[model samples]
Target: MKKSMANGIENDWPPIAASRSARNTINPIRRIVDRMKISPNPAKEMISLSIGDPTHYGNMLPPVEALEAILQAVQLPTSHGYPPSFGTLDARKAVAQFWSRSNYQVKPENVILTSGCSHALELCFDCMADPGDNILLPRPGFSLYVTLCQSLGIETRFYDLIPDENWQVNIDHLESLIDDRTRAVLINNPSNPCGAVYTAAHLRKILLVCERNHLPIIADEIYADMVFPNNEFHFLGILSENVPIVSCGGIAKRFICPGWRLGWIVVHDRHNLFKDTIQPGLIDLSSRILGPSSVTQAALSHILSETPESYFDDILHQIQSNADYFYHSLLNTPGLQPIMPQGAMYMLIRINTKDFKDIENDKDFFTKLICEESISCLPASVFGIDNFFRIVLTTPMDKTEEACQRILEFCQRHIKSVT
Candidate 1:
């Protein structure tokens, strides 16, 4: 110990360290990707398929209506003030109406605006369980779930998703993980790493499990309604008969505006299960951060109502086109199998490690691809999977084609010979 005397007082100081929450909050993607010190090939320009942000390539962007709304909002004298902690009444009403259906009506009173989908999830997790309580998450799921749980001192129990079956949750495995301390089950439809959309029947099966177990659901529907041509997106909140649902969604993915940092939690409590407890807790917790930007909240109503369906149609077409190309192109590649994405903006490719001479795993493939071919993709290990990597489908067609060609060549060069 070191002490210093000043003004007739002795002071002792020790090295400062991060809190347990801060130290345990590890983002696997950043930790893994940043550790790879290999530089991209000098001869070739880098094509990054790693990032989840759609705005990275500039080919996709927020619709004209959204932009105009923001422009109109910024000029307003009333837009500069702080909104209610949960959200402005108008903004919350907009969210409710946007998600409302002919069969089910969403109430504005149940909505809680958040900074982003991530924050929405954080609130859901925080409100549902305390430290040492467990939440059942999907295996090969979004890494943020694990990070947030760990940071909050909540236990994470993973249930497997069947990749061959379009990454559907193993319902049996999911049900088996439930115990006395299990607080909630997190479901990500139109999943990120897998891009698998659940059917109505599949969603019903999951709902049955939760209903039987009396467990509430935390639905990650950030990619809601972003399915491909043949597939349909189903909201778990809509499907659940009795199980209460807290759906976390935002305009980030659907509107291509990640930087906007606006999201909301829609509480679907048909039986009033959450009306007395979790709902109020979420609203109370939101008071700490005071919600998102007032300007953005002012724009949210127009952003939700004025954006044409054709805008979303065009976005889905582009993503499906990219998914089609990657699925077909990589099928011919020697040691990789691309899982056809049903929806969302990513495709997971399984690296047949045994077929490659030098590649050991997904991380090896990821490192070598960037170093030799100047192509970057995320190793699925960060998403709690192995021998697979995920790539974004938001790149321009030209870049997608170039990336496919490079990946083909990279795999061809590394594939083992049968002799």
Candidate 2:
């Protein structure tokens, strides 16, 4: 061994490699997005409709109540200290009260706070299934679920969501994927890529499958209560009677504050199925990160309680208005089919590649759009779907109109000639 006199170490040291967890942890969005090496048109200003962050545009912002609460919290002596690993009692209680419905009451003990909804999901996935176990996720779903499951050494099985059916989960397909090693089902309502909201009836159908298979549910309700008029958002936990539910949520979307880094898991096990096992496991896992910021937890109560209903109404109005415009405007764009989102701040448009002259797939459409029109939207391949792209509806009306017009022109330019 060639050793140095000072360190007595081998000159040819073995190569260090990343752990299996780190190596397997791939974000499909980042991976697919990074492959687009082309630049946007310099002549036309770039309008990004890809990012999920509601705060990307200045038109939407957190309410004064939340800001005031945070201001008050930072000044308090108690807010400076570390809270319990899961969360402070007051913070947990506030979450419980906020989520509690007239028929379905949530308890503080069943709540486990984390750094953010992502952290809450990580804890839920970690606690529910061991390595080699499988979890069923939605196809065309938020890619993070696959990233987390892969990183944790858990196998991911996907169920289909029919785009024509307002992006409703194909119930038969969901149940068909379940097998002996399947541990849980992850359902994201007002889903990210699809922007589809599940009705109570539809949610009950999913719960029935879980109940039959004795599988627990990990409800990704981060966009809870964020539905447009004529549509109702149902919590799987509230609708579930027999199936135990671990619901992950936060104020990230509704409050329009993604950077707050505060979220929680609400355990809903009416029959105490998770009381001794999953509940304690989640709490134990939360200890590793020590939960969210102390000041944020301290401010949560005031933020939850004092924020007016009109604030949410205004936000919803803005999102819905954008949705309406995108749906109607893109309808005229040849080779593009825009699915009007029932809820959430996204609109998923299908690219009819066969109807286009040169557009091959979603990635091709995405590349050409940015290079030509300076409009950036996420290709749905990142979300495990093809020939579709997703756009954010949180942009101001003016920007939304501009994006629609640009997209229309781009589609028309590439669309196959009728003659």
Candidate 3:
């Protein structure tokens, strides 16, 4: 056997290691997205509709006041030091004020700010779960929870989200999966890849299930403010007190500052179950872990406290128009079944690979489309659904039209070639 380091231990793998789950599993979409960096064709211009990045269309500019706050924070002699492990009082209060408008009586004390929603999620997992304790996750959900759980040696079991019926949660299936070892149930409203918003009735069913199981709810409402027609946003915190609920939100999607890397996990248990039981653990975890950027925390006061009412109204209107445009345009395109997205900026469409001779699966379809038409879409296999693709509507209206046209022409060419 090979000698180990000076510490004198022999190991097959390197030290500073993760659990088995972490070592074995890779996020499939992330792997493909990584390899997509370099393109083969010299003349091709790639129109990216795969990632939900809002900067592509140029609708969101950094808030002017936010920049001033960041500048002021950094230049101040006292601001360079580490922020309070739980986040600064000013930032926490601003988060509270922001949530107050939604009628969620969030106290600054209940907020745990971290390095964006990703860290907030990891914090939640650390606080709530132990190895062998699994959490229920949505199939094709955001990979953050799955990744976090794997790293923690906690199991992440998935329940299905029905696609044919407007991507509704299969609550019965969820109930069937939970047991004593199950810690929480995670739901993403205005879902990431699907853009399917949960209704009040859906929330009611989920809340009831959680109450029955004595499990807390992990609600991801990052797209809460980006809602459009036929979909009403429901906050789980507003729904029930029977079970603890941790609601995660950030300025990333709503204000389009993903690079800002600021977000919070708010404890919304009406009965203070989390505060009474889990809050101390969460605070301790956050204290030991590093906090969000001090400069970005400074911007929180401006971004959260002073969001213009019209700014939000215009954003919703733009998203609605874009969703409509993509839905209608895609409906007219053969071999693509566009589910009308009720909220958020994604359109998950089924690719009829059987109709296209060369395509074998979603990956094949997406790869061919990217190589031939220079339009990029995310494969559904990444989202736990095969033979479907997600298209982002963050591009300008004209570019949205052009992208759809390119997809149409590509499909036609593909069909002709197959014949």
Candidate 4:
């Protein structure tokens, strides 16, 4: 294929040529996972801590209520046909009611169901920021935040999360990053990669900052209910009055049902700000995708309204037990040290990159470890960090302990001798 010199029509390359936006976007998690193909580790079994999906390890399962609800939904005859563009009235209403707060309650009109939290994020950005505008995010945060922003041609300005301070946002850096073109501030309470939980006070401060800056909050509370026993999960919807907090969440983490692909965006606008502006955009986005699976959509009401608190507590207990085991094991190890995770199913293991002369960065170290030990973890560089890797603790406690053992041995193998 050849391009004309004058008009310069786009190249019609055969079986090739990704668009500029496609070329610019990269899923670092997929990149890291692709290394397993040729890695010279154990063929029969690999202890993979790289995957964030809770179902991979066979430890987590759908609740009886969810499964029964879905089964009942399938027999309803309505589940067979095409679903509503936004979502079922009952489901959307359930989502709104589920996230309602005392001060600023969400209504069904403000909720738009989508495929997953990823889709919710894409939709959120599609409505809020035009191309070339910047949004603030947490550094050492979820890589998807950057990826989702990049594909939309919107810029992502990352503020720091102080690891020493329980991964709380560096407020000064967050404030400094704001500028005229900044449209939104994204918050991932119970952050990915770094299993940090923000306190109510800290989150209120963020809301205050965004409110003062006239920036609406795109709150990613997907892991909202996955906090540890001592930590409480606070919804930004409850905290914000002036700022329009568009909360994106789902049953993926708390209910351990990522495969269902049912998530939603709830506009928690106290003054009808997002309801007027972004709510239509969210609906339009859902219209294009036709919402999440019909059966899953039907189950939303029961899942949100009927699931017992005991089920949630059990899931948290399992995750906390696994996290505690792994964190203690890493701390006891000579070379590996993990920042104790406060929430979510993952945490970061801080590798002394400087001590290991052979390793150039987090990616290099992870690649080598996967090849040598049959243990896999996502490099922290995927989350915009240099010397750490994410350790998913969704596996059973015994398996997590075993993973820690293999990691310690690998660190011992390559760790530089002390002076």
Candidate 5:
């Protein structure tokens, strides 16, 4: 068969990838270190106190027994199949059981699994918000929230965490940030960068505010299990009956398996707000994503089902020891003022840039320290604060001590040179 068609002159059309909203306004912090070219890759030997990645000090990696369980799951053909849209039944049940062990009465139906806590946040936002709706987040937070909401065309409003008051959430400022367009408020307890743990009393106040506003609370509790000495970890799910609460958590930081990519977002709305209003949206979103990894889901099942208190006791002991050592190191170091961290792996230090003639800001201090002292640290300016640097206490005990000495020597030399 022969067909005659009118052919038009073809013009070159450019293919564009992603929308304007998807572009990241704030770059990743690691880019600063990536831009440098050092002989023999100095980072191999340098003391890294910048990123909170646990691999720097070997805290997050699991034991051989945990690896065996994961391997066993992979070897089974049944575990290779695509999991349920919400997550595997075994995994969800395990998660529910884990909560029961913690004295919370939760069921498998309440859990929704995702790749990690970050994905859990995305799911929660997608479920709760419409385009142009705002969510309240903490100032100087993880910063990923800004990028995530921006990409989704959702807006984020910040309320300051009062650093002078042990990085507590400023309740008045938080209430002020909420409005008609606000759908939810997010809080990360045992917070990132500053290591702020919200007390039960503080969380109660937050619930009251949310109850009044008729808005849900998104509690990011990935670091829930990492509280240090004298710090109590409060689970919002226990006290979130009146107000709709979406509590996110996972075994990544707690069980040291971030690579496993198993995390969950549980709806704690006993009044059925999330079930009625939010669950449908989350279902639509989760269905399209085809759910989290099947192998990891199975691994999660095993870990959650057999959660040994001994495992956590060991981890808590190690972290407490690490925090203690790092705190003393910072206190002994000259010209650096570090607030003792109650939880998490990082501490922010006030840098006296005025004392160093060549250094003007936190970035400048970080650059020089990396080059001269062979120590890499984060500048707090990136987290909405200036003239201060953040140090990750996740490094090995010996390295922490050594880095503190090196930093002290560098400061002394800089002061002498300036004078």
Candidate 6:
């Protein structure tokens, strides 16, 4: 072995050393957040649109009932104990009841409580695919999906999500990528980064392709019910019964309580496919982890049962307003092309590199913009794309406006001379 000396949060002075695992564990989102923290902005305060948590905004708070439930749960003596590996019966039952619809009902047994949607993903990959197996994922999507799969020795192959078609999966591309070693297909609806919600018809086609390939569907619906105007959020469960679907979601986004760290994985095995294999394996995997907070799980029943539809409606409305304003403004700017988001709290704005006489690429463009405008957005290359960056629409209206205005100024400054 060579030498390891004070790299990141890993090995420090005089320590035995950091493992190779610690050296390679990188989360792109956190990387941007850390840079934003360390980078000296001449401006008073830097505005960041880099993080995905909805609760970061002061204006958006979790439901009053959910908050009260947490308070009550924290007081209960039983809340201090460890949560069961699968989850509390009440929490699992609430999940089943909340997600269950007429003719598409799921029993409490189907829900496996997890620390968060990310942990839910870890468990799904743990059960569905072994080392050396591969899974198909959406390009320009959540980097966590790729990180989680790769960390466990499970490989990932990305398929393009058609930008012009509202970020729907290119079924042809998807079908072509499948082979004997392929194990599962993962999708995020009301997609993160792209903000494109898949239509029911399109979802069916994707599911059909997976079914033909005999692979399981790992649907990351963590943005569940955050759908904005003109688009309906389709639950993957309702679309297919023949194929096995692992729907991952939590109180993080919907309830605006990401810190609560309460999430669940509901196995929709209509045909009893994963009942014996993956289902049991998920329990074993979850067992190895301490699992979600007992205090959070204790309150999950009340939170899921009582949160009003009006609460979700208001949250969606705010996301819609911010996204629309940013999209239109960026579109009108000289050196920018923004893809209007149909849902979620993100939109990818393409940097018109040809319009910039001085800037080199997306990285150079964003670095300059960050230092000059006191604003931070994630470069698209982190999510497996380039010439684009993502903006979160969860900021308050006034700040959202200010950030967009700053972005326009940056774009206008770099306008190349037209012959």
Which candidate has the top score in lDDT? 1
For model 2, residues 1-419, the per-residue Cα lDDT tens digits are 45565666558656778998899999998898897698999999899999999999899999999999999999999899879999999999999999999998999999999998999999999999999899999989999999999999999999999999999999999999999999999999989988899988889899889999999999999999899999998888888889999999999999999899999999999999998899999988998989999999999999999999999999999999999999999888899899998898898999999999999999999999999999999999999899999999999999999988998888888888999
Candidate 6 positional error at 242, Å: 1.0
Backbone clash total, candidate 2: 0
Off by over 4 Å in 4: 1-16, 32-38, 101-104
lDDT of 3 by residue, 1-419 (tens): 35576788775664566767668556667877677654523466677887777876677555665666777777877666789987999999998877774545779999889888888888888788999999999886776677678788888899998988888999899999999899999999988888888888888999998998899988888888577855689878777668788888888888878888888988887776776668888888988766888888877887776667777777677767778888898888878889988887888898887777667888878877887778888887777778889988777777788888888888877763532
Candidate 1 residue-wise lDDT, 1-419, digit = tens: 56766776677778888899999999998999888898999999999999999999899999999999999999999999889999999999999999999999999998999999999999999999999999999999999999999999999999999999999999999999999999999999989999999999999999999999999999999999999987889988888889999999999999999999999999999999998899999999999999999999999999999999999999999999999999999999999999998999999999999999999999999999999999999999999999999999999999999999999899889999879
Which pairs clash (backbone N, Cα, C closer than 3 Å) in model 5?
Answer: none
Taking the tens digit of each residue's C-alpha lDDT, what string does model 5 give over 254-363?
A: 77777777789877877787776687677668787767788878777666656677777777676667667766776666566777778866777777776675677888
Q: How many collisions between residues are there in candidate 4?
A: 0
lDDT of 1: 0.95
lDDT ranking of the models? 1, 2, 6, 4, 3, 5
Return the TM-score for candidate 1, rounded to 2 decimals: 0.97
lDDT for 6 (candidate 1): 70
Deviating ranges (above 4 Å) for candidate 1: 1-12
- Cα lDDT tens digits, model 6, 1-419, are 34555663444335577775566567766675566534637863688787787777688999999989999999999998987898988889999999988878889999999999999998998788988899999998899987787777787899998877777888899899988999999989979989998888899998889888898899999998778776889999778868999999888988998888888899998899999998889999999877899999999999988888999899989999998899889988888889988887899988878788887777776678787887878888788888888888899998888988888888778888677
On residues 1-419, what C-alpha lDDT tens digit does candidate 4 reach at each position? 66555577766656677898897687767766674465657653688888889999778887889988988998997887778888889999999888777765678988888898989988998888999999998898898888888888999899999988988999989999999999999999888988888888999898888888889999999999789878988888887768888889888988889989988888887887865568887787778879799999987898888888998888888888888888888887665678998999898988877777587778787888878877778889888888888888888877877787887787777878888
RMSD (CA, Å), candidate 5 to true, equals 4.7
TM-scores for every candidate against the unseen true structure: 0.97, 0.97, 0.90, 0.93, 0.90, 0.93
Q: Which ten residues in a row have the lowest lDDT in candidate 3?
A: 36-45
